[model samples]
Target: MKLVLNTFFSFFLVSTLFGQQYRVLPIESYFKDISFFTDSSFTPIFPVSDNQVNYYNTTKEQKLRYATVGHYIYQREIIQVIKKEGAIWASPILDIQSGVERGDTAMSQYLNVRGLRIEGSMKNKVFFSGSFYENQAVLPYYAQQYVTNRGEFYPNSSDSSYHQVNAVIPGSARTKPFKTNGFDYAYATGMVQWQVLKSLSVSAGNNPIFVGSGYRSMLYSDNSLPTMNFRVNYTLGKKWNFQLIRLQGLNLLRVPYASNGEALYERKALSIGSIYFQATEHLRIGLIEGGTWTRGDSIQKQAVEGGFYIPIPGAATIQEGINGKSYAYLGLDLNWRVWKVLLYGQYGRNPYSKSSDVGQIGIRYWPFKSPNYLVHVEYNHTSSNAYKSSNPRINYSNFNLPIGHPMGAGVDEVIIRLRAEWNHLFVSSSTNYYLNQSDNYRQLLPVYEAASGTNQQVLYETFELGYNFNHGYGLEIFGSAKLRMVKNPLQNEQSYWFNLGIRTALNNHYFDF
Candidate 1:
């Protein structure tokens, strides 16, 4: 652990001493800039007059030459136009990372891309977005690690050896334990927007539905169904806005199922929609219903959901919602002049159709006002049944479902985190406590798990520090340590990692451009 910590800090110090460039800019400045009319009283630049023409030449040609018009001249500049044109796009990033578990060595190298575009005019518009990721890694078995099950319980025993598991399908020569370098998957979606009236517009696309303000929701992630959708949005009064949407499922990815039989599962397709009303400058109310078609095949159903946000004293904010799929939740976010806080709590029945009720709550606080210097502290708690059988199974029996199997259940955790950022430097520390009760240890070990299991109460801690240079160069160093106080006493795990990243421009690199 000491060696790992020393190595992590050394990397960050070296990088900070000789790293590339890094700069901070406002979020709004990141988007395109457009100035349609210079002045309300001004006319077009064409058709010049004698005196006006001379002035135009003196102001535009002889002087700055910023722009030219008749006597009524206008000076307007468009910035960051390329970003809005959707002509600039980025592919996924590649990172090399490594870790140690119980003195066992684990390593991974992966590429991931997340891209989005929004382009449209009063006449027409189109949006495209998606995620593609490929990961290759060396992993350990479940029994060797603590895991959580569908019922939210931690397990104690390891499954049979990988070589001993069923290797072939029954009555057939098909390979059973399909093995490969790692996991690979991709998802893409697009949407079009059209103006139906001066104050109304309609859009259709394949997108996830986010109806509420919580971090996780039955409708938040694309777990159950991926659907094509259509929506109509309009403006009523000066402060009122409305929207309605309908969705249809489309299965494109292949998922595995336990039934063994090749089941091309088909969803009856569900319809879902939402309406948002901006009652005031700081308040919004949204009503949602039906479940959009996701890219999976666990269930073909829909339900109602609603969300609300309001700002009160001390900049306090509250949001709550109940959606179909036996899920319900509520959350709060507040900002007091010197202290920023976020408090959230949620409750649901079989969030993923598992046979257990799940509940979670978290709180975060930030101190300091300057954007360059800040401190944050957070705590989170989660409790559930942790049973495996009640968990949803991956519908891999069909080729149209998304990748990976259904997530197993049985997770109970408490996490505390602290972070600080100053200038180009950032540091964060976190500690996690786990309680396992099932046999799904493998599912809980890897950052990504495929099965269910139980993980007994254990303590895990991590620390990270990084620096960004002004020349688009970035470097980060981090380390983690995990200890199991119970059981056969697996070796206390400790590892260190270093990352070098760069953001290069394909064309012009200026943010002002």
Candidate 2:
């Protein structure tokens, strides 16, 4: 453990001398960059981590000759301690932002965030990265209610405080009280990767994964906290590629604390695999399979059950069908590019019930074959019990957040997004319509089968105008507006929000739902 700590700290400070390859790029800025996707030369299977290093190396940035400040601000990392012939490199990442949102009440909602990302590479065979973030925010009313209600838990027999605590923040680490009526939270994640062979690489980290070609995915999305996971990737020539992932997750509701009075959430394991085939230059198909199991039996705790390593697709589903030890699911992914338009769709089914299924379809079109402008439209639907199970422990979720869609289950949504860019200025807008159940669905909890759920409708819209200062860091100055109108038998809500701030946006924080 001491050696491990020392090695991690050393990498954080200064990268060793090795060629860094397969360094995963940040999602929001690089993966979602319209310019890169629209370029005909680039081929992507949405959020695959291995190909990023090659892409980064090919795209060179322009540098200033005489003005040191200009070079640092425009092209160079904020603090580049080592940059020797590209053999070894290390840099610090910073993202600080402050903004305000106006909603139902006279009081304004405020947000303040500070974060640091450390990335390094040791030669061509090894790479590592880490990030830390601190946040203090008075969120919108709906979001605040979600956090507070879910986190309101009482103390157990071995606990110190007798009262309840509301400290859980979705898509982030747990929180503590901040100032008056605000929440403060901090979290960290890191990764280390080693290339074992020319066509194979192994990595482990607490990282978020996105597995679709659209703004949302029915298979997996980065809407939840990053879980600790181990991954293996292999490439077989140009047409075949394979990947396997083992995820360690937490079920906070089962057992909140241990005898030592420390938070000891129930443990769960998930094994997932993907096989991708590039049948033609413009078409791609992928098969996704996974299974989840609880750490122990109903009577006592024990090691996780087996059946995690069967590589063939649909094997997990068959195994679950026979023994019923784990909950399994199967999905299919397809994408095709025709001229300037990209079309994609996904289908997923739960083995527990035939009615438990999900589907998504979307189209992305670039006018004039240019990346400067885009029009995106998508539709998604989930059955009432799509991700839920009779046993909460086996549900498809981690840390109380759904592993796939943020809308959870029993929801149908339509989305349209538009973006236009010129020079350094850009404007983007999004509109979403959702028809869902009144009670916010959570797959991690078992629901009452006899009770009838209310129908609700929500219309959410957002618009943003920003000036891009740097592409590599995703640094930008922006102002935004949001409108949300909800209608339901339980209650009705209408809110208008506005804010302005400068930020280095990287990860996707899903608050729109």
Candidate 3:
């Protein structure tokens, strides 16, 4: 371990020979609007929400959402009960209020939501932040099925016995019961970071993250579940940045899970190390290695080692051969900017395994050089077993949610998006089409189900128009429509929603797949 750490830091030493300052932000995708901003920033891998919190808290001023519309956001933050106690501070406030009515349901066919955010810094060295939400919804037919089974935990147990429910498609996801008419769940994320050195930082938390500049990532993606994870970032001047990430995830099962009377969650560890470069003003490239290891019957933890083989991105395979079973994947990213437009592409695969891989290519156009006004399109495809393992316990998932693409595997997606903004007024739309292999989610056995060649398909589209109100704490008034068409149905499934709400953050969770 000492040798590994030393070697890793040596790269930073060589990189910083010219000396460069490092910056970190707590929010996973905090530094945004790249199309309109000049500085180049590294994008953290998805679902690891607390990256660089210490760096950001110490070096950069918190970006206030009050874009000065009506100035109400500042007042709401008056809920801040503490300020400046020897470098300690706080901002605790309730966020959004929203209600949505969809499809042919009557007065109660709606969704209701409330949220909270708590943030602060301490001792000038540590920073922490958390967000919470309580939501209840009368989802469309497919959505209800997706969430319930997507998280299907059969028969909650008060202990020995279980409270079971009927299931469709063999089983369902883990779904918590809600009000008489809908389903409800609580989502929470909290993370803390500490600055250990001028050039290095550590962050640990549970949340979702998005990697890459495209609509999706070939390696890790936001269309997954929040994970309990830790991340380390080191900068070597202006030319190189390195990141090491580790995750402890579970492969959920349909039973009232118990391991020797303990809540039995499968154990899987992921180690990803990446090096990024700014070759020139317009060219950037990244090389990354990722390893997935499953803790079979024994849940003992594993060590993180040897994942940074640059010329060979499959270093994880070395340990996998010694161990019982594991998966290793590698990625290459090319990001090039031409004046105002950015073109990017990525490819990732596990050479140690078969029938599991992903490839993506996409571009973003900033017409008029405005971040708020933009067009994006991307194509992505995943082989059937991309994130899966022979051991169902090691499949890349938590709460039955994938840690990569929302569609799981054996899927291809074409996504297009358009957004136009004028200060407080905004209009955005996205359409995604999917060609899915039938066994995408169900083939969890030691071997993946063979592809049938023939596939199922789905197309989903959404349009929204909203205006920021006072830019206050992300408060806005919006109306939106969504439609999904499945291959068999032939007819489209439509839903509509409108609300007055505050969204202090983007929707990082991938529930729309």
Between candidates 2 and 3, the one scoring higher on TM-score is: 2
* Cα lDDT, all candidates: 0.30, 0.67, 0.56
lDDT, model 3: 0.56
Please provide TM-scores, in order, for all candidate models, with all chains considered together. 0.47, 0.86, 0.75
In angstroms, give how far residue 325 of model 2 lies from its true place.
2.6
lDDT of 1 by residue, 371-429 (tens): 22323332223233321121122121111221111122444456565656554466656
Q: Pick by TM-score: which candidate is best? A: 2
The better candidate by lDDT, 1 or 3, is 3
C-alpha lDDT (0 to 100) for residue 315 of candidate 3? 54
Candidate 3 structure quality by residue, lDDT tens digits, 1-513:
777657645643442331221222323222333311332444434332223222222222233432333222432342432333312223332334344555554232454556666666554456677766665555555555555445433334454323323221111123356665466656777777777775677888875555666767777664445667787877788778778777665555333444466456445666667788878866778887766666553325454334422223455666666664566667887778787777888888766668788888987787864445778888988886687766555565544566556666788899888878676688888888886644234433222245443367777788878875432234456767666666643343445545444444333334355
Over 4 Å off, model 1: 1-80, 83-181, 186-203, 207-219, 222-339, 344-357, 370-410, 430-432, 435-455, 458-460, 469-513
Q: On lDDT, who's better, 1 or 2?
A: 2
Lowest lDDT sum, 10 consecutive residues, model 3, at 164-173
Query: Candidate 2, overall lDDT?
Result: 0.67
Clashing pairs in 2: 18-122, 18-123, 19-123, 19-124, 20-123
